[model samples]
Target: MDTRHFTFALRHHMVADTLLLEFHGELDAWADLELAPRVAALLRRRRRAVLVDLRSVTFLDAGGLRLLLRISERSPRRKGRVRLVLDSPQILRVLRITGVDGVFTVLGELPVPFAADDTPDDTDVPA
Candidate 1:
Protein backbone atom coordinates (compact mmCIF):
# COMPACT_ATOMS: atom_id res chain seq x y z
CA MET A 1 0.00 0.00 0.00
CA ASP A 2 1.17 3.49 -0.69
CA THR A 3 2.14 5.35 2.43
CA ARG A 4 3.26 8.41 0.56
CA HIS A 5 0.12 10.23 1.66
CA PHE A 6 -0.98 8.00 4.46
CA THR A 7 -1.07 10.93 6.85
CA PHE A 8 -4.51 12.53 7.12
CA ALA A 9 -5.88 15.61 8.75
CA LEU A 10 -9.25 16.36 10.28
CA ARG A 11 -10.23 19.98 10.75
CA HIS A 12 -13.16 21.35 12.67
CA HIS A 13 -15.14 24.36 11.55
CA MET A 14 -18.31 25.52 13.22
CA VAL A 15 -20.48 27.92 11.31
CA ALA A 16 -23.92 28.70 12.64
CA ASP A 17 -25.37 25.31 13.50
CA THR A 18 -23.26 23.23 11.15
CA LEU A 19 -20.00 21.55 12.02
CA LEU A 20 -17.67 20.78 9.17
CA LEU A 21 -14.96 18.14 9.47
CA GLU A 22 -12.60 18.77 6.63
CA PHE A 23 -10.24 15.94 5.77
CA HIS A 24 -6.99 15.82 3.82
CA GLY A 25 -4.70 12.93 2.76
CA GLU A 26 -5.21 9.21 2.71
CA LEU A 27 -8.35 7.79 4.31
CA ASP A 28 -7.70 4.12 4.67
CA ALA A 29 -8.10 1.71 7.55
CA TRP A 30 -5.57 3.54 9.65
CA ALA A 31 -7.44 6.75 9.10
CA ASP A 32 -10.32 5.42 11.16
CA LEU A 33 -8.18 5.83 14.23
CA GLU A 34 -7.99 9.53 13.58
CA LEU A 35 -11.46 10.18 12.15
CA ALA A 36 -13.87 7.53 13.42
CA PRO A 37 -13.45 8.12 17.11
CA ARG A 38 -13.71 11.85 16.66
CA VAL A 39 -16.86 11.54 14.54
CA ALA A 40 -18.39 9.11 16.98
CA ALA A 41 -17.64 11.50 19.77
CA LEU A 42 -19.21 14.32 17.80
CA LEU A 43 -22.36 12.30 17.19
CA ARG A 44 -22.66 11.56 20.85
CA ARG A 45 -22.16 15.15 21.93
CA ARG A 46 -23.31 17.50 19.17
CA ARG A 47 -26.84 17.95 17.91
CA ARG A 48 -26.11 19.72 14.65
CA ALA A 49 -25.43 19.25 10.96
CA VAL A 50 -22.13 17.60 9.98
CA LEU A 51 -20.31 18.23 6.75
CA VAL A 52 -17.40 15.85 6.10
CA ASP A 53 -15.15 17.38 3.51
CA LEU A 54 -13.20 14.62 1.80
CA ARG A 55 -12.23 16.66 -1.21
CA SER A 56 -8.55 16.81 -0.30
CA VAL A 57 -8.18 13.17 0.47
CA THR A 58 -5.58 11.59 -1.79
CA PHE A 59 -6.44 7.97 -1.19
CA LEU A 60 -8.94 5.73 0.56
CA ASP A 61 -9.12 2.13 1.61
CA ALA A 62 -11.59 -0.20 3.28
CA GLY A 63 -10.56 1.10 6.66
CA GLY A 64 -11.47 4.61 5.66
CA LEU A 65 -14.68 3.48 3.99
CA ARG A 66 -15.74 1.75 7.17
CA LEU A 67 -15.52 5.01 9.05
CA LEU A 68 -17.69 6.71 6.44
CA LEU A 69 -20.13 3.83 6.60
CA ARG A 70 -20.37 4.10 10.33
CA ILE A 71 -21.03 7.82 10.13
CA SER A 72 -23.64 7.38 7.39
CA GLU A 73 -25.46 4.69 9.32
CA ARG A 74 -25.30 6.14 12.79
CA SER A 75 -25.20 9.91 12.54
CA PRO A 76 -28.76 10.45 11.31
CA ARG A 77 -30.18 8.66 14.32
CA ARG A 78 -27.72 10.16 16.76
CA LYS A 79 -27.16 13.65 15.42
CA GLY A 80 -28.84 16.32 13.27
CA ARG A 81 -27.52 15.29 9.81
CA VAL A 82 -24.51 14.07 7.80
CA ARG A 83 -23.20 15.12 4.43
CA LEU A 84 -20.04 14.18 2.51
CA VAL A 85 -18.10 16.51 0.27
CA LEU A 86 -16.31 14.52 -2.44
CA ASP A 87 -14.28 15.77 -5.38
CA SER A 88 -11.91 12.92 -6.10
CA PRO A 89 -12.98 10.80 -9.02
CA GLN A 90 -10.89 7.90 -7.78
CA ILE A 91 -12.48 7.99 -4.37
CA LEU A 92 -15.95 8.53 -5.81
CA ARG A 93 -15.44 5.58 -8.13
CA VAL A 94 -14.41 3.38 -5.26
CA LEU A 95 -17.44 4.41 -3.28
CA ARG A 96 -19.66 3.86 -6.30
CA ILE A 97 -18.29 0.44 -7.12
CA THR A 98 -18.62 -0.58 -3.52
CA GLY A 99 -22.16 0.87 -3.39
CA VAL A 100 -21.21 2.98 -0.41
CA ASP A 101 -22.15 6.12 -2.29
CA GLY A 102 -25.80 5.17 -2.08
CA VAL A 103 -25.85 5.59 1.65
CA PHE A 104 -24.56 9.15 1.83
CA THR A 105 -25.78 12.59 0.87
CA VAL A 106 -22.76 13.43 -1.30
CA LEU A 107 -22.01 16.99 -2.39
CA GLY A 108 -19.39 18.67 -4.53
CA GLU A 109 -19.06 21.58 -2.16
CA LEU A 110 -20.13 22.39 1.38
CA PRO A 111 -23.12 24.59 1.96
CA VAL A 112 -22.32 27.35 4.42
CA PRO A 113 -24.21 27.15 7.71
CA PHE A 114 -25.97 23.90 7.09
CA ALA A 115 -29.44 23.94 8.60
CA ALA A 116 -29.97 21.52 11.43
CA ASP A 117 -32.98 19.26 11.93
CA ASP A 118 -33.59 20.70 15.36
CA THR A 119 -32.16 23.79 16.97
CA PRO A 120 -30.24 23.33 20.17
CA ASP A 121 -28.41 25.80 22.35
CA ASP A 122 -25.17 26.74 20.61
CA THR A 123 -22.20 25.05 22.17
CA ASP A 124 -18.52 24.77 21.27
CA VAL A 125 -18.10 21.10 20.61
CA PRO A 126 -14.72 19.96 19.31
CA ALA A 127 -14.33 17.30 16.64
Candidate 2:
Protein backbone atom coordinates (compact mmCIF):
# COMPACT_ATOMS: atom_id res chain seq x y z
CA MET A 1 0.00 0.00 0.00
CA ASP A 2 1.16 3.50 -0.73
CA THR A 3 1.98 5.29 2.49
CA ARG A 4 0.97 8.70 1.36
CA HIS A 5 -0.54 11.28 3.65
CA PHE A 6 -4.14 12.19 3.05
CA THR A 7 -5.57 15.66 2.83
CA PHE A 8 -9.02 17.10 3.40
CA ALA A 9 -10.92 20.27 2.61
CA LEU A 10 -13.90 21.96 4.19
CA ARG A 11 -16.46 24.41 2.90
CA HIS A 12 -19.12 25.72 5.20
CA HIS A 13 -22.03 28.12 5.28
CA MET A 14 -25.11 29.00 7.21
CA VAL A 15 -28.56 28.22 5.89
CA ALA A 16 -31.19 29.72 8.10
CA ASP A 17 -30.16 28.61 11.63
CA THR A 18 -28.23 25.60 10.38
CA LEU A 19 -24.50 25.44 9.74
CA LEU A 20 -23.72 23.36 6.68
CA LEU A 21 -20.19 21.92 6.52
CA GLU A 22 -19.04 20.27 3.32
CA PHE A 23 -16.02 17.94 3.43
CA HIS A 24 -13.86 17.04 0.46
CA GLY A 25 -10.89 14.70 0.08
CA GLU A 26 -9.86 11.88 2.39
CA LEU A 27 -11.02 11.95 5.99
CA ASP A 28 -8.27 10.15 7.84
CA ALA A 29 -5.73 10.71 10.59
CA TRP A 30 -3.93 13.48 8.79
CA ALA A 31 -7.12 15.24 7.89
CA ASP A 32 -8.15 15.22 11.54
CA LEU A 33 -5.49 17.77 12.38
CA GLU A 34 -6.98 20.16 9.89
CA LEU A 35 -10.60 19.47 10.68
CA ALA A 36 -10.80 19.14 14.47
CA PRO A 37 -9.95 22.69 15.43
CA ARG A 38 -12.18 24.24 12.81
CA VAL A 39 -15.06 22.11 13.94
CA ALA A 40 -14.29 22.94 17.54
CA ALA A 41 -14.39 26.63 16.72
CA LEU A 42 -17.71 26.25 15.03
CA LEU A 43 -19.07 24.31 17.97
CA ARG A 44 -17.88 27.01 20.30
CA ARG A 45 -20.09 29.45 18.46
CA ARG A 46 -23.11 27.43 19.58
CA ARG A 47 -24.76 27.12 16.19
CA ARG A 48 -28.39 26.05 16.38
CA ALA A 49 -27.82 23.10 14.04
CA VAL A 50 -25.20 21.47 11.83
CA LEU A 51 -25.30 19.46 8.63
CA VAL A 52 -22.13 17.62 7.63
CA ASP A 53 -22.04 17.13 3.87
CA LEU A 54 -19.84 14.11 3.09
CA ARG A 55 -20.71 13.74 -0.58
CA SER A 56 -17.16 14.60 -1.60
CA VAL A 57 -15.30 12.66 1.04
CA THR A 58 -13.45 9.87 -0.77
CA PHE A 59 -12.04 7.99 2.22
CA LEU A 60 -12.84 7.54 5.90
CA ASP A 61 -11.23 5.66 8.74
CA ALA A 62 -11.83 5.00 12.42
CA GLY A 63 -10.46 8.38 13.38
CA GLY A 64 -12.77 10.06 10.96
CA LEU A 65 -15.71 8.09 12.27
CA ARG A 66 -14.84 9.05 15.81
CA LEU A 67 -14.74 12.68 14.84
CA LEU A 68 -18.21 12.45 13.40
CA LEU A 69 -19.45 10.77 16.55
CA ARG A 70 -17.89 13.45 18.67
CA ILE A 71 -19.63 16.11 16.66
CA SER A 72 -22.93 14.32 16.97
CA GLU A 73 -22.54 13.97 20.73
CA ARG A 74 -21.64 17.59 21.22
CA SER A 75 -24.27 19.08 18.96
CA PRO A 76 -27.20 18.03 21.09
CA ARG A 77 -25.79 19.56 24.27
CA ARG A 78 -25.31 22.82 22.43
CA LYS A 79 -29.00 22.89 21.65
CA GLY A 80 -28.38 21.82 18.07
CA ARG A 81 -28.82 18.83 15.83
CA VAL A 82 -26.23 17.20 13.59
CA ARG A 83 -27.08 15.46 10.35
CA LEU A 84 -24.76 13.79 7.89
CA VAL A 85 -25.09 13.82 4.08
CA LEU A 86 -23.31 10.86 2.52
CA ASP A 87 -23.34 9.81 -1.15
CA SER A 88 -20.43 7.41 -1.34
CA PRO A 89 -21.22 3.72 -1.16
CA GLN A 90 -17.82 2.87 0.30
CA ILE A 91 -18.20 5.39 3.07
CA LEU A 92 -21.72 4.26 3.72
CA ARG A 93 -20.61 0.65 3.96
CA VAL A 94 -18.01 1.52 6.55
CA LEU A 95 -20.59 3.21 8.70
CA ARG A 96 -22.93 0.27 8.37
CA ILE A 97 -20.30 -2.34 9.11
CA THR A 98 -19.19 -0.46 12.16
CA GLY A 99 -22.80 -0.10 13.26
CA VAL A 100 -22.31 3.64 13.48
CA ASP A 101 -25.01 4.35 10.93
CA GLY A 102 -27.69 3.91 13.54
CA VAL A 103 -26.06 6.51 15.76
CA PHE A 104 -26.57 9.41 13.42
CA THR A 105 -29.22 11.12 11.39
CA VAL A 106 -27.72 10.23 8.06
CA LEU A 107 -29.25 11.68 4.93
CA GLY A 108 -28.67 11.35 1.21
CA GLU A 109 -29.10 15.05 0.67
CA LEU A 110 -29.74 18.22 2.57
CA PRO A 111 -33.32 18.50 3.68
CA VAL A 112 -35.50 21.39 2.68
CA PRO A 113 -35.96 24.07 5.31
CA PHE A 114 -38.99 23.43 7.46
CA ALA A 115 -40.58 24.98 10.47
CA ALA A 116 -40.01 23.28 13.81
CA ASP A 117 -43.49 21.82 13.59
CA ASP A 118 -43.18 20.68 9.95
CA THR A 119 -41.46 17.51 8.88
CA PRO A 120 -38.80 18.07 6.23
CA ASP A 121 -38.34 15.62 3.39
CA ASP A 122 -35.11 13.70 4.01
CA THR A 123 -33.57 10.52 2.66
CA ASP A 124 -32.70 8.22 5.52
CA VAL A 125 -29.95 5.63 5.33
CA PRO A 126 -31.15 2.04 5.50
CA ALA A 127 -30.58 0.03 8.68
* Model 1 ranges off by over 4 Å: 1-6, 77-81, 113-127
lDDT of 2 by residue, 26-93 (tens): 88876676577777767667778888889889999987887788778766445434778988899999
lDDT of 1 at 78: 44
Looking at candidate 1, what is the lDDT of residue 48? 59
Cα deviation at 76, candidate 2, in Å, is 3.4
Q: Could you tell me every candidate's TM-score relative to the true structure?
A: 0.75, 0.77
What's the true lDDT of residue 60 in model 1?
Answer: 89
Candidate 1 lDDT over 1-127, as tens digits, reads 5545448766665666566667777887777875677777776655456777788789988988998888766564444347789888999999899998887778986564543322333322223
Residue pairs in collision within model 1: 28-64, 29-63
Overall lDDT per candidate, in order of appearance: 0.71, 0.72
The runs of at least 3 residues in candidate 2 whose Cα sits more than 4 Å from the true structure, single-residue gaps closed, are 1-6, 77-81, 113-127
